[model samples]
Target: MNQNLPCTEPRPIPAAKKVTRRRSPISLIWIVPLVAVLIGIGLAVSAILQRGPEIELQFASGDGLDVHKTKLKYKEVAIGTVTAIALSEDHHSVKVSVQMDKRAAPLLAGDSRFWVVRPRVAAGGVSGLNTLLSGAYIALDPGKSRNVKRAFVGLESPPLVIGDMPGRQFVLGADDLGSLDVGAPVYYRHIPVGRVVGYVMRPDGKGVDVRIFVDEPYDHFVTTATRFWHASGIDLSVGADGMKLEMQSLLSVVAGGVAFGGGDASNGEAPVASRFTLFSDQTTALRQPDSIVQKYVLVFNESVRGLTVGAPVDFRGISAGEVSRIDIDFNRRASDVAMAVEISLYPERFARQQRNRPTALPTQQGLRQILDGMVAKGFRGQLRTGNLLTGQRYVALDFFPKAKAAPIGWNRPIPELPTQPGSLDSLQEKLVAVVDTLQGTLQRVDRLIAHVDQEVVPEVAPTLRDARQTLARANAVLSSDAPVQMELRDTLREVERAAASVRDLADTLEQQPQSVLTGKKASK
Candidate 1:
């Protein structure tokens, strides 16, 4: 019975375990992190694609620039960043590598320009002042060309903005550089309209050649007759017009500048790269009003100590020319030294017209004929004092009727003007003659004084002695008393009675002339 019960229980327990399968919510932990990882991968891919090109810049110096810190700017806007700085292979310059922004990609061209922006004081003015506090940066000027590039040569100094601006270029010639400098402003009627870009000594080394740029609208004022002058620094002149202070502007006084004007706008603008002379000052620019110039030579016999190059050559108080050269030449054949002066005359300077007219000037032969006529009429050249205090002299042409008649000497290339002694020379000669005459007169006076003392004085003493002796003899005779005196008195009385009788007879004859002749007229 126990065995049977155990078998039955075992069989029933095994079939009852058919339990139900339960369904649970999925865990959200891994979903958030998976989505975030996918987003990160997409952002990284976009960043790699958007990166701009890298470029290399060569510069003389790495001053004020820092790798990974310095920025590239265009129009004061950041456009790129400097990523690396290294020395060039030659070690003569710095090699800077930059990574530009995507927007600035088109700016990389063959003609692009780069320069460091630092505080600078130039002839133009004070610039890049903001860099003083904000720190220095690199500046970029986009090229106008279409060609692309990756390497560029950097400028040591900032280039003029006129490179892309509308303007014109011109060349000016000057005797000297004066105070002019690169970046010096160019003015029109005291208004700044351009600037000087470069300067160099001419091939002949006689003058300086300056390159200038004039901005739009104002460049039209420059014509063939336009005049340019140095307006740099201050021009202080104490003259007949009193103290004259001239300057283009206050800035010009400190930084130097140039001025241009004096052309009629109606005459049309001068072509590009036109050449003009740069006068030293406004006065000099205005001095050469005429276009036609004639050259002549003059030989002076007197000392030319006070004469200098650029001395005025005047005709009757009117400025006619300028002394171009003053030299002393010793003639070996003649064995004498002569002072030769070369001058350039502008006849149009004396013309009544304000503007020069196109006309044929007198030829060399015609000039010779005119000079001959003038010489025959006593026209001569002489040196005259221009400034007595400075002892400066000038050439003067005038008519002197008493001057010796001379003919024009055409032995040299240029016709020689007849010369006579200057007024100062004549005065010196007169003084010398006066001194000689005075010397002769003094000698004669000395002789006259000697004759009076030696000859006249001795004769006067003898005459005085004779006069005194005669007076003494007369006195002795009057005072004498003797017998001869008594006898003389008696004789004198007898003579008196006889004289009375003769007088009575003369009276009777005078009363009766007929009685004296015929003794019959006694009745009277």
Candidate 2:
């Protein structure tokens, strides 16, 4: 019984000896580690909150983009930074990762435009020159639309005009694209007011269409009758007015440019998207459109050698129109070849202008009536020399009162205008006749001269020899002092005295015709 109790008591005593461990306030050292862990978590959250969104931008080249170094700028203010650079999947472009500032997040829109800004020279002169010292950067242009976007494709070149510029866009149709270039200056009276933004070939393959932008105040000057011309390079023209040199500016001369002016501004501005013709030069652009052109066919009986498509068709001394076409046709009835000249005539050139009258002429039927009257008045077309040195010819329409009458038939495809021989041709014919007459006269004169040389010359020589021999015989007789010569001298003296008396009497009669009939009276 004592052993069992002792075992129980010892267990109870052993349990008491095991000290009770109490959890004391956590140690300050432990608190330090926990606070540190909490601080680390707070810092991580702050970092997450501050980091900006990453966006992908594709570019034609990575020329000026640099990871961590290149920046995206708007109005010269940094808005984002490039973080990475990589080749696109197709390897045709460069993929750039940009970290855009939170403030710039709204700018990442579908219509937003971006381009790398580096030192470059363009028709507008040196651009992005500031980038040379500060290194390259990406330029951003905000869009007007509200559509949001993340991925973007950058432009290879900067836009001609930046965001929402106040201007008007006009399309100019031209036969060819001359010296015009992107960013080329557009001048108004030598003042830079706009720029050439783009150009494209027409779908019909007929011509090129140039797109231009004119600034606000300048756009107002463009009217329905406005003219546009290529003003690039130095315009050197040598014409009847003498040498003329024209240029918009030195920059225009070097790069290329355009000019617009000459319009009926009194009618107000030109409607937007109005199609206008682009001329090669200012002279062509400034030509007046003051008349309606009527087509006519001229059947010429003479050569059309110097006549060209653009030859001037004149009425009297004034230009009425231009030559359109020239062709040869066979006259089946007459079995002869005839030359047909198609001409466009503007009746306004010769028609008397009434005071305050409209510039445009009447309709086709009215023109036909006028032409018919003119034909009855002996109106005829003839080719005439325009420039003697260049051998250029023009059609001259004139009235020939004495010419053979010929009627213009209304049944022809084109109204036929009668033609007469040109002045030059008539002059040539007269000259040929005169040359024939001169040749005949020259032949007769040559025959006369030959006759004189063969007959008259020989007779003259024999007569001269006989006279000389007679003179020699008289001289020999006088020098020898022969008795017969003395007797002849005495006889000559007596005859001379008698001749003197007759000469004195003739002188008296010559003084007065009546001296022979009446005795001369002496004056006191």
Candidate 3:
């Protein structure tokens, strides 16, 4: 085959056409890097969308706080975190920047409250114990308003009573602060039902205004007649009735507290913020105001040593009045001083005792007439010892049937009430009079003794001498060996012999009753 084809001159072999292929926009190897870039961009956008609101909180101090670790808790659940802390423009406080989660956005009301929760010691008690282990953090007590706010002023301490708590608030007007302070407990029937929230000086600066909170269920106990008093320290009162001790609790005794009661719960519940007077004690709070007071002056002619101002003026063992003042005056009829005691008589006391009471108490003029009639009927005033140990005395209004009649001095500036000597004074006067009579009797006894010694003794001496002489003679006659004795003995023997002869004759006559008008009875 090669010898025949060689004559063609070995034509050159045609070259193969060059092949051109279009490439894809991306290579398989480059697709891996593009996917990674897309994932990174998506992550960055997600982070931007998840960002939260930032708020500034001005605080007095940055105590127990870290830049980024501190958290804001609502009911122990973290809702936000502290991002930054720096000094305020005024340099007086620290400004804290907080980033709040979107979920907690609704809680940022205009009235929302913010405070630092640390281990706190207050009048209420030790709180924030959990913070000791978890470290200090910010706490939130949301407001009820719909308005929202961002920047807020942080409180140095937690509020004693949270606003959202189920309770009612009331204002109390007080004369002084005493031991009462924020967190002081409020008691009803010795049970803790509320707490003191705050206090401030009055605008007049004459007193203080205290705010208190009472929890639900117990708030219904407050009524128009509700009475409040400071149950502080030991409520100890020693009076004529003896000693009384009342305390709500041990904490009340130490830190002080407020107690309210003695009102009928059936009455209308006092509205929140109702004004009430804060009494110093329960007694004063519960005491009914005395109306229809009648003042009278009692002039006493006896010593009022034990009687003092403020002494009770009791009538029939019931207190009707009190001694308001005491004054000394020269007695017109006697050489000693007299006492003028002014008394404040509450006529309502007598009216309350009447089983069939009148619509109203007696008028002043009618009261005077009544008093005048009573005085005519022997009504009198006297001082009686109330306590022997304390020597305290009280005025006693009583009827004295035998007391001399004395009319009231109506013409004087102050009407005078007739008064008799005090019970103790009467006894003292009786002792004095008895002693005087005894002294006079003793003088008479002395006179009698002197008269007997001077007048009767001389005459009695002579008579005694004569009696002695007569007794001596009688003694001589009675002597056993005297001649008179011998004669008397002989006469006695003669009489005995005659007596024997008579007795023998009587016996013979009796034997012969018929022989000699009846001889003596026969010997048998």
**Quick one: best lDDT, which candidate?**
3
Q: Residue 17 lDDT in model 2?
A: 69
Lowest lDDT 10-residue stretch of candidate 2: 6-15
> lDDT tens digits, residues 131-201, model 2?
88899999899887788888889988899877778888899999988888999999999999999989999
Please give the range of 10 consecutive residues that has the lowest summed lDDT in model 3: 515-524
Cα-lDDT of candidate 1: 0.85
Candidates in order: C-alpha RMSD to true structure: 20.3, 16.6, 13.4
Give candidate 2 misplaced runs (Cα > 4 Å).
Answer: 1-51, 234-254, 271-274, 290-292, 347-352, 356-369, 445-524
Q: What is the lDDT of every predicted structure here? A: 0.85, 0.85, 0.87
> Candidate 1, residue 61: CA error in Å?
3.0
Q: Of the candidates shown, which would achieve the greatest TM-score relative to the real structure?
A: 2
RMSD score of candidate 2 (Å): 16.6
Relative to the unseen true structure, what is the C-alpha lDDT of residue 2 in candidate 1, on a scale of 0 to 100?
71
lDDT of 3: 0.87
Predictions ranked by lDDT, top down?
Answer: 3, 1, 2
Give the per-residue Cα lDDT of candidate 2 at 10. Answer: 38
Candidate 2: TM-score? Answer: 0.73
TM-score of 1: 0.70
- How do the residues 460-490 of candidate 3 rate in per-residue lDDT, one tens digit apiece? 9999999999999999999998999999999
